[model samples]
Target: MRRYLPSLSALHAFEAAARYMNFTRAADDLGLTQSGISRQIRNLEEFLGATLFHRSGPRLVLTETGANYYRNLALTLDRLEEISIDAVRGRSVDSSLMIGTHPTLASRWLPERLGAFIGSYPDIPLEVMPAMPSTDFETTQLDVAILRGVGTWLHARSIELFPEVLAVVASPALIPPGSKLDPLQFAEFPLLQNAGRPSLWLNWLRLAKLSYSGRIQGTRFAHHEMIINAAIHGLGLAVVPTFYIRQEVANGQLHMPFGEPVQSDDSYYLVYPERKFHNPNVIVFRDWLLRSLRKA
Candidate 1:
């Protein structure tokens, strides 16, 4: 006969206690009394024939074996929870897709082009979440994400959505009339910078073969919108993504003085976990996104 494993409830109690090193907190997390949680851990340890915790006064510490076991168990449990949640959510929604992306991209780029996607997949409901720096896709209920990076996704499989072409853009108001100065003359104005891409201005200048005294001097902002707004107001020239400022340029709010565009290694990518590739919702969303990019 094969041996039976302990119940999930007992294993969960043990994991919580091992993590917090406090029965009271574990009880709170599990919604059980401190004594009840203790009982569960004791039962689990007894069933396993090993001591999982060392009780020292009010504090609890994991033994060497307990530490090793907890490390492996926690990882397994986390993955299990992820899979369980995915399965449950997948069954609940047959035509809904959840996507996550940076706020700037969602605001400036996706809004204009998403109508095409909606037109093709009229039956599918697309849910977009503005993912912040701290958002983790594995823990969250996200089906896909559009991320900005140097084509590297640590855990997720990534596909290049678009290459970022950066250029020095300014309002027509800033340039003097009948003044056709060389590229180095750009150093005269206050430089607007993007905090996420500090080296953008320098890279663009280098690509234009322009030399300036204050190559690295500039005022930096966190979002691309702020940089564009500053440039539109004629505060200074900004190195911004061409796709982001397409509407502004068309409206004459911003002007790219340089005839050439500079391409950056960093670009937008569509990413999702390898396991989710076969999911119907994920597949539909990925295909729609790729098609939209192609049209753009």
Candidate 2:
């Protein structure tokens, strides 16, 4: 038994005619003569065994059945178009965004807030990759990157998230029993450092208008979080971004000695290639990030 189906061309003819409700306009759209469009529409109505259009008077109007069929057929055509585009592109019809972020944001900032994005875009799959913010976008699959910087990324568009504040923190055991800490005493304890940010302590001191003549050095680490951990274990006093250790400060895992937080010249930024300015995935993530971070 042959399933009921008409020539795709005939269905397209009827759809176009139903769209304009005028055979002449539909014929012009499909690059066919009005007679050809009328013939195709007739073939379609004959196959369906239904009068799709009322032939009363010269004005053509879709019948009740034809109007209902047109609604469902329009949806089917849209789905078919999406499937065709996705098949050619080899990607999900529902967009998927790959984000690159540094360890601090990826571990501390993003984890708590990403669920909102997931909830909003349940249809869009999102993947967060721990990567340097300045990683090459041309060579990577990452659609967007969130990283800390002074906001001058050439060839990339950026939106400022928040300013960074560095503070001197230490384990409780490292501080001696005293009310006022002699600024010079800072040199006595091993200064925890991250090789990636060797100037953090120097710049922080400069901002505080304090100077240490002694060698400001200690166990160097590649990652910022590791420096925080070293300071927590009493290995040394560490200078870190105040934002990363909010819970630690509240829970007494780390203590900030008497001093104001040092504000860096840089801030965290959400960035992507300028070429991706209008990419759907990047646009949604960018808007979501700005709203989420700015609100908090």
Candidate 3:
């Protein structure tokens, strides 16, 4: 028998106790008495020759070693539960693929293209979640994420899908017939802004080799989709990603006042945990995504 291998009951007790940081709550969760929970944890600690918790009155706090152990153990327990559930259901261990991405990509880019991936792999259950705040494999169950960034995420593998190419666009009504406006002239109009990228207008002006001292004032929106929609309604000139407004531009809903799209330093990337490099679902989705984008 392995000396380091603690009993399942002790492990469960420690996990529950650490999570709640209250032995009574842990006992209630596991249908055990408070003392029973305490005894299990104590025995486990003695077995490991390490104090896992610091008891101060009624409150319990995890020690440094305990915190590290809990993080890894929690993940292991979650994976074990998933595998057990799959086994009971008579399916593969990893039966689902959860993808996290921004709303812009989810609504505009993915909705039209998801069907192809679904058609190719019917067995893998798919769930698309909004990558709110930030996506972290350690903290989230997401198998993969499509994020807009410079292609660098800690403890994760990232592959750039495409560089962010921006273009100055406005409603056709905003731009008169056969009229070309220079950078300074275009700045005179109401310039819509993306709240996330507040420096976009200033950067574009500097990139265009012009310095405007006026404060950039407009209705700022959180997402590019909102900016595009606002631009279509003739609110103001919106600088948006060129690829995002392709259909809008082609269908005469929005018009580009600029000659060519400006490439940004950031790019959209397919990011995933380094551990999931060999995941079949991720691989299939990655390949399909690249092929689809190339065709588009």
Candidate 4:
């Protein structure tokens, strides 16, 4: 039985042409003449019985059908290329583990502990990518991810790592060394804010039982690391996760006047696609991560 599929050469030609929207550039990319790319795309369109491009325009444009086709086709081509490369290298289908995590955790917390994982499993290759906001396994090639939330992601199995512990810290110059902070005094100084987590200060205020009514005029930072750096420079008071600021506190760069750390409802979780529950690499990594963090 013949499969109803277009030729690989024609598909490649159309994909490249659609990506650059210029036959000359696509031909240059594939080391072929402009006519060759155009002919291949024409053949592909004829085979599929659909108009893939608008030739009447000043610049080449993909039709609605062509755009939809390209989106799915691109992902398929990428997966095919990955499998082909792995086959050429004589490795198993799932030979490597790609982990995605937030930039904050990757830069501050993970590096020191990664060495132990490498030393233990020298045979397993690893790649770390910065996954912002959230992880979508269907759209990404990551085998596992570390996320901060309540372990409620759809279609993913989440393993709780640790609950978030926050501490109110500021430069010693701003609050003075060895001075205790009163709950109401929180509104006295400028409050630095995390743009990503706007409710952090409000939540902390509620937990501390302080009803702040004074106006807060402070700079809002996009990243948590920036907020920590700003607090270190005596710009304002910042509430940061204790884990990320342990070194700063130990070195007296930041003073924690608020005595007790505040607990957050969210926890850090190691998550993977529910379908990957039986995958050997995912299992190995999950075990290693849980064990490593447990001892920390």
For residues 1-296, write the lDDT of model 3, one tens digit per residue. Answer: 65668898999999999877888999999999999998999999998899899977766889999998888888888788878878798875576888999888888988888998889888888889888435556645678899988887876888899888878888888886356777577767888989988988876776666777978889999988899899999999988888788899899898877656778878899998887889988898888888988998
On TM-score, the leading prediction is 4
Clashes within 3 Å, all models in order: 0, 0, 0, 0
lDDT of 2 at 100: 86
Mark the 10 consecutive residues where model 2 has the least summed lDDT. 133-142
lDDT, candidate 4, 76-191, per-residue tens: 88689879978898875477888888877888898888899889998888889887546655445678888889988876888899988887898988999888768667778888
lDDT of 1: 0.78
Models 1 onward score TM values of: 0.66, 0.66, 0.70, 0.72
**Candidate 2, residue 175: CA error in Å?**
1.9
Residue 161 lDDT (model 1)? 86
lDDT of 2 by residue, 92-204 (tens): 65487878888777888788888999999897877788877556443344678888888767668888888989888888888743346765567877888888889988888
The runs of at least 3 residues in candidate 2 whose Cα sits more than 4 Å from the true structure, single-residue gaps closed, are 1-94, 176-179
* lDDT (tens digit, per residue) of candidate 1 on 42-75: 8988998998889777678899889887877776
Question: What overall lDDT goes with each candidate model?
Answer: 0.78, 0.81, 0.84, 0.84
Q: Better model by lDDT, 1 or 2?
A: 2
All candidates: CA RMSD in angstroms? 7.9, 20.3, 7.5, 7.1
Runs in model 1 deviating more than 4 A are 1-95, 132-140, 176-179, 209-215
